[model samples]
Target: FMPASLLATGSERIVSGLFLGTALSISSVKIVAMVVREMNFMRRDLGQIIVSSAIIEDTIGWVIIAITIGIATHGRIELASLAFTLAGVAAFMAFSFTLGRRIVFDAIRWTNDTFRSEYAVVTVILAIMGGMALVTDLIGVHTVLGAFVAGILVGESPILSRHIEGQLRGVITALFMPVFFGVAGLSADLTVLVDPELALLTVALVAIASLGKFGGAFIGAEVAGMSRSEGIAVGCGMNARGSTEVIVASIGLSIGVISHTLFTMIVTMAVITTLAMPPTLRWALGRLPMGEAEKKRLEREEVDQRGFITNLERLLVVVDEGVVGRFAAYLAGVIGAGKPTTVLRTSGESEADPVEAAHLDEIEKGAEQGREAAKEADEEPAHEAPLTRRTHDAPLSAEAVAKEARKGYGMLLIGLGRAVTAKGGFSRRLNEVAGAFEGPLCLVLKPAGVGRQMPRLGPGSGRILVPVNGTANARRGAELALAVASVTGAPVKVLYVARPGRDEPRDTVSHRRREAVLKDIVALADRYGVEIETAIRSRAAAADAIARQAGRNVALIVMGVARRPGEELIFGETTSGVLQRCPCPVMLISDARLRRDDEGREALRSGTGTG
Candidate 1:
């Protein structure tokens, strides 16, 4: 304000300067995110801090802009009116973040589940944004603040998958955003800059914006205990005004607080600063050194990028009202605590089977437990809303499940009381359901005599046993085990199950292979921030070793097995042995392969593999 006052003298000087200064004070969050992503610094400490600071600045900057507009609206700021406006703004923000967020989440979930039309959720999101914007406008503030709050609320919903986010971003980038910037750009005329006085003023504006933002950010970074290199990168990063300046300047112009000349100057400063940010920030960040802790964190994050459990976008649970179903729900809740999980309750063989309220209650209770566990672990539930959706549209059948499978599920979980037969093989009903979904699946089977003794598998319940053979399937199972342990705080025991004849000689090569496999599992545990105990047992059948290690205290045994081509759901001799002999509940995660019919297998063997 003092800098702009050098050129102005009248009553309008103070208000104009306030508007222009506020416009220049904010940084562009979108631009910062793009640059960070481009530089692959999004997961780094410095990158996170820079992005978080920009977000906070943008939020607070919008509120200040609203208040300034409120003062301008009243012609001359009266203390009573100003106080009332400030109170209203605070109340609105508090309500939006607290109760209003819940309302928005519920609305989005309902729209997503109830509608069969495409883009129904997106439609409801826009309506919610418009409604909130109208409320803010009624409260004498700008509509953008309300829209911003609504976007945050919608983004927090658990069901807002990356696909939906891309849809929204696509429409904005393709249509609305281009028009917005085009109009803003066309309004600025370079002809007015030919005047020497205005040209000099524009230069002065750029200098002031750069120096003030850089110095303030550097000082603030140092005060927060950041190193000198980090402070320099932050200052350089925050200097870009970009879209934010255009928005504030446009608002000021529309409200008659700033003239066209001042608006053009602000836009020009925005352009120059934004153009200069990338190179400067890159140079500044290049000088910073990575600590040992940061390097380890980056390695873990890289593992997460290629992990199976971490990349599951959605989960489907097929269950019944029996104990097995309830147990499956509990495990599903833990595995999918951070993803959207849909529960499809089997109403029995007859179409007239009633949907049991008890089953629905179990699903909710299990999901609640999972949410609590996630919160206790300080794990970020990317999508915290829309925990579970229950469906009972059709009776249990191949056709019914096949229909649901078309909706794109990453993984399926099946748990029914009769899923296993007396011969310890998968029952016909279980095979039917499993064949309907072609993706990866986990089958929760109840051991003989488990009956009503199976307790809720939650935090501190018991130990988890994972058998590893150093195969891709084994690693996948280990990853799932680690995820579950991370959420439930269960102690994990990774047992290296060596084949009886293959690992006979404990030579150097064998020892090195075993060590490498165990080390890989340990690294996976670190990715999920879980500690585990390792055990190596050889010169025994893989199934026998696994069953012996799964003692009474072991609550669950999770194994990853590959599906063999056959008319039924077959998982080789080893998996069958573990399923028949292990006392605890077993979770079998199978590879992405469906059972091939007899004709298909015969054709391949006879050298006539055509369809």
Candidate 2:
């Protein structure tokens, strides 16, 4: 069929056959990934294999396609040309995954943090993709390879937020994808298939493609220890060619490697296979039952997916270069791991603000302390988001924050030198700080002498304490505590303070509720691979119990509480009490947005000011 099809063109049948085989064998990564994601099977084990295999097929297929493209560009297939293209591709991929990887991440992070313009990061991403595509074309390979590689690199960037990802995804899915496939459809004259001979060829082309891909995937699955039914499903899943076929045929047509009739046949085959794929793959996927292990893993992944801190897109740090500022830097670095963070450095408190008068000496030393803490944070994993320090010459104010807020930070973290301000100690600064952002908040308060001791902190191999209630905020705090503990290999102590009740021990009064809370937090710690301990304080106030635990040589105290809207950042009496007397530094984390009603959210968005 290959020789007969190419007789008019007088091209080498063997080379044309190689191109046809490569094109037919490749599956569409975009098409398959979209279907899998739509079905919500992305985290399933079988789904993982199918998508990963398609990715592998796309990669190998592109390398082969690049070689052929190189031949077509030079008007002939030759050994020297093939080897040169292969060498160029090899070098390109090696450099791309290495230095190119770093460059791409840095470019995206820098653009995201440095620019205040809307969609600036999205524009930068598109530029990176186009730039890489041009590089591949200049190196005598297909630009498709560069574009595909670029997508992979961009997808892997830690700083890539859900909002940005979804935005890019929308453009591709709604506009570019439809346009590409629509253009392919318009270019393909199915009228060529009206001839009996060409119609027969299209049918044969689909059969050959379907069988070869199915057989290859089926055998691979079986060899990798899947059951017979699983292998059959894998074979069915791999049969789709979709857009990959159209793109390959288009490329071949443009380069004169295939005549118009052959291009039409390929496009017809693509349309048929793609149309038949969804129902077939869906049926096969439905037939495969989930194993116990897969179920548990998926459930755990789902929990992590919904977790508050885990989903944070970006962090805003407002601090001075003071002792407490340094402490906030360290905590932010720990929690902000992988999260893009912007630092707002207020040089010092204004002399007129009562905070400066209350803690004049301490405020003066904060800037130096913040620098050292930031330096220590830099010592953590380099793959995490790059911290951008926004230098401020004036005292921190809501208006300065309102400008950065336009850049879309998802959380606000405030750490300053003085615990008290003229407005009312801690709550005033928090009230002023949280006003500019419509997201969650974290407040890091330094204990009296913790500044001098902070340089000695944050290799955190000591015990960490977290007080847990069954509330969402408490769970979030426990999760954050577990994460910090996991990084430092510290043991976590879960405390539940129970007051006395009628005819029962104080701690025993709420034994059932305390047990449930402990159970949940312990599971959370297990997920993070951190050790956890549980305790109950009989007949005690929550603040007193937490403070006593913190006094027990605890490395850090993490309290999760909801923020209440008031004239200022007054969380509650218990939280305030704990902060006032706790000997160690305490971290107060809140999920203000989670509890907001529609009206409240509108108020927040309009900057009517809720913490």
Best by lDDT: 1
| Best-fitting candidate, scored by TM-score | 1
As for candidate 2, its clashing pairs are: 321-366, 321-367, 322-366, 322-367, 420-425
TM-score of each: 0.83, 0.80
Q: Model 2 scores what on Cα lDDT?
A: 0.74
Cα lDDT of model 1 by residue, 245-359, tens digit: 8988888877778777777888999999999999999899888888898898789889988898878877888987677777787778777765777778875423223446555
CA deviation > 4 Å runs, candidate 1: 1-11, 311-314, 338-410, 435-439, 447-452, 455-463, 469-472, 487-491, 495-517, 529-555, 562-574, 591-611
Model 1, residue 52: what's the lDDT?
93
Off by over 4 Å in 2: 3-12, 35-40, 191-196, 222-229, 275-296, 318-323, 341-385, 389-405, 420-424, 427-434, 447-463, 496-518, 535-555, 592-611
RMSD of each: 5.5, 6.4
